[model samples]
Target chain A: MSTAKQPDPARRNERSRQAILDAARELVTEVGYAKVTIEAIAARAGVGKQTIYRWWRSRGAVIFDSFLALSEGAEGLALPDTGDIEADLKTVMRATVAEFADPGFEAPIRALNSEIINDPELAAQYREKLAGPVDEAKKARLRSAQRAGQLAADADLDLALELLYAPLYQRWLHRSGPLTPEYADALVELTLRAFRP
Target chain B: MSTAKQPDPARRNERSRQAILDAARELVTEVGYAKVTIEAIAARAGVGKQTIYRWWRSRGAVIFDSFLALSEGAEGLALPDTGDIEADLKTVMRATVAEFADPGFEAPIRALNSEIINDPELAAQYREKLAGPVDEAKKARLRSAQRAGQLAADADLDLALELLYAPLYQRWLHRSGPLTPEYADALVELTLRAFRP
Candidate 1:
């Protein structure tokens, strides 16, 4: 049970990590963030508690990893980089609409994000595991478009980045509105009109 | 303790409700949401628990009502409705930045919003009491601006609403970036540009 990220040794270790993540994800979905524990995850994964502690700090950290893995496997989830910035953004946003609609990824992520609001340590893990990569991907796309003169040269990339992605996250978290495919296209159009000058 | 809005004959009940709201807001700031109870609110306001609960559903509901009252009193806090859409939006958003910076409002609000994520009933109360009004205020401003020819006639008001407000909410909830006055100006400018044909 160490806080350090050690190098993986063999295929067996990879299998064990996968099994542990799977079990933890399932248990958290079945129970919840407050109720899921190392003992339950161990029993489900057929591993010792120390096995989980070997690579993660707490249940929050393990669940964060599980969400990251799930996001990785989701199809059409990447920010597209085709030369047409409008088309690429629409493609990515549409993909996100589908991803958020998926049961496997949405429920656990929402539950974890809900917890992060009150827990500082878990909130940090959430920003690192969830917002960090997505933020980077979006900034890269905006920068590339600006560089190619598709977007206004003076367009603030960070503002554009936040503008494009924030609505999706808001809808997903608040359950305030439908992130339908039509909504995705409309968002893209609005963003492009704003960014294109 | 039941959940129903009551009519006050002498307005004694109205005064009591305001007193309870004031006490709840003050105590929630000091003690946080989880510890702010019906009994404490009653004691602080010199009333009984049934007196407090005669009008609202739960502690979260009372806290939410208090938050709403605070926002509503600051008359300048509503979205500005000058014929110049950009300037009006910037005025409203700048005011929002000031509100976000106010510790008296921000601390208790942060605590209460965090707790609501885990409580669906509270979340519903929150949406109605807080989110719904702010959203309605924005829509009304947009409508007036559109009518004044400050915006395109056919702009999709619903999606436009998301574009203007969701980014600020997302940043506030996630602690992803600074919700500065500059960012607010940027949002208004970006949204205005998007509406251009």
Candidate 2:
């Protein structure tokens, strides 16, 4: 064994993992979730198919993990708390609108959504692993608002988050309307009006 | 030629149309949207491939029209206008929750949604054909509420509709929450509270 030429196993493993995720994301965008296969992902990532199989159980797992990796950076995300719930919400919501509007996120998110809709198991995994954490962060902000008397103490934060985010999401999914900062602000205004203390 | 028993061409065409739609709906539910195809739909409908192509453009079109045919009976539906928007909206929204939960509608609708999320052209057609008329009826009810001094006089009806329905829709799509009649009623309450004059 040439010890001087040995590659760091940990770093190499991390590189392969990232390559697989990026390949999954790119293939989903280019050809869609259904057409994205493990073989294709392995080829695109320059890894052996066994390398992918060693990590992910199925195509859906790889795709879900691709999305999870994208949001991994935002794992610690917390909505800004400015005491003024309205302002904080608008800022966060507008940021959401901008993110959805970005070309980088558009196709992959649409692919992810389609996958989630069709596969209930993946949907469950997504809620627990992906949405669960982000929702908790947003809820913490809402709870803070409740403490500040800015929102009703009895407000169902889950429902409130849905109200605040779903309209934009539906619009984006269906292309039913524009996703503008103004639209984001309007949703925030209406949700606040709906849930006022 | 059995002229005495000749079937009318128009009636034959109508039968073929219904059979095709039923077949499309059935196949989508059975195999999911990705696996459903014109050939399967044709075989199940007992019609020729040319017949499906004659009336529809693609698999997405057929799936969308299957949904359209289901709602064709309710094309002229008007929301109950007892001058009480809250009760009327609750009634409509609860009916929606029930519809989404129905086994008869479940798989086909999920397939349709997956298709819509991935295909922009199909999404536009859905908005125009399926959602437009339904939204118009709901808007009329909101307008009546406005005239009754219930909702804000100049409320944006489109935005109001989204707030009222999108929350329930997101929950159903993500399977993130239940689609109870109580859930529907809560949306109506929060929407009404949000837009109350």
Candidate 3:
């Protein structure tokens, strides 16, 4: 019995929590956020509605958390550091184009957009939970380039990040244009040229 | 009788058409899109609902047409061309910030966002009737700059336009940051540098 470890109930609870989030994400993808409910998520996860209620305040909270989790997994998945800002930005942008093109994430993202207009509460949650983190991370990367003398010293960090990122979002939500990888490469190149001192 | 002059029925009809559009815009701003109806617009316009139906396919049509008419008035306002592309872009962007800050347009923009989500048919109309013209105008202006050698020869025109424009839309729709002239100027400067060859 020497050096043996005790089993933890906390670990079991954590597994249940992840299962609930996975079920919510799956249901949201299938039925849309308008149709997703705590009861349905609970049933799918084999947990109780009370379990969901205990953890989150609204259906939006559950969905937003799921999205953040997915994004977190994909964070820095393809951002390049080839020492050439143009090539690196293009590499990252191309990868983002592919991610946004994925059918798995498209429905969930569109669902988020559909709710942002009518529901201020959901909109706030969406920005704080998902958009804010992604924006800040990208901004940090751009700022790092600036600090490394790869970009102009006085560059507007927020605008620089937005220039590189926002067009992809505009296309995805509005269907204004094809979000192809070629489109991404073009954005990266244009922005990289524009940013140089 | 030697110099018989005709009263222009076309002029009179144009005034009446504008009056109806004004009333409809006012009503939507006051009551919101969900509560606005054919009967209500007709009552406010002091005309028959048939008159509105004759011109528009639906209430969405009326609201959208009203916005388009307003934007046409706003269009000739012009992108400032001070010879320097950076300064000119900044001037135009600052004006845009001021325009969005105006409550007269802000309410309508919110209404438009909701319409885009709640009614797909209306969204399609908005894409054609509103976004298309404005977006194309901006793109054309950017392309003119590229031809004038203000930007790289290989710059992607669409992406260049988005790089200059998307941040403002992101900020306004999300309410995440200030819609100030200074912010617009910063964005212009940043984009100009990023796209510079």
Top DockQ: which candidate number?
Answer: 2
Q: Give the lDDT of residue A59 in candidate 3.
A: 83
TM-score of predicted chain B versus true chain B for each candidate? 0.78, 0.90, 0.81
Candidates sorted by lDDT, best first:
2, 1, 3
Q: How many residue pairs clash in all the candidates, one count each?
A: 0, 0, 9
TM-score of chain A as modeled in candidate 2: 0.91
Which pairs of residues clash in candidate 2, taking residues 3 or more apart in a chain or in different chains? none
Task: Summarize candidate 3's per-residue lDDT along B1-197 as a digit string, tens digits.
Answer: 64347777777668767877888788877976558888888887778888888788878778877777777754444455555777777877888899888877887777777556545677677777677767676766677678778876776666666777788887777776789888888777767666666
Assess each prediction's global lDDT (C-alpha) against the native: 0.78, 0.88, 0.74
Give the distance in Å from residue A49's predicted Cα in candidate 2 to where it truly belongs.
3.0
Give candidate 1 regions above 4 Å deviation.
A1-20, A32-62, A72-78, B1-23, B34-62, B72-78, B115-121
Per-residue lDDT over A15-37 for candidate 3, one digit per residue giving the tens place of the 0 to 100 score: 88899889988998898666888
Cα displacement (angstroms), candidate 3, residue B120, comes to: 6.0
TM-score result, candidate 1: 0.79
Q: Which DockQ values do the candidates obtain, in the order shown? A: 0.52, 0.87, 0.40
- Please give the range of 10 consecutive residues that has the lowest summed lDDT in model 2 chain B: B67-76
Q: Which stretches of candidate 3 lie over 4 Å from their true place?
A: A1-20, A34-62, A72-80, A117-124, B1-66, B72-84, B117-123, B143-148, B152-155, B194-197
Q: What is the C-alpha lDDT profile of model 1 across A45-158, one tens digit per residue?
A: 888999899988877778778877777633334567779888888888898899888877666877677666656677776677666777777877788888998888888776
lDDT of 2 by residue, A78-103 (tens): 88887889999899998999999998
Q: What tens digits encode model 2's per-residue C-alpha lDDT throughout B1-197?
A: 67758878988999999999999988877877778889999999999999999998887888789978877856588889987788988889989999999877888788878778877888888888889888988888888899899999988899999998898889889999989999999999998988888
Model 2 / residue B68 / CA error / Å: 1.3
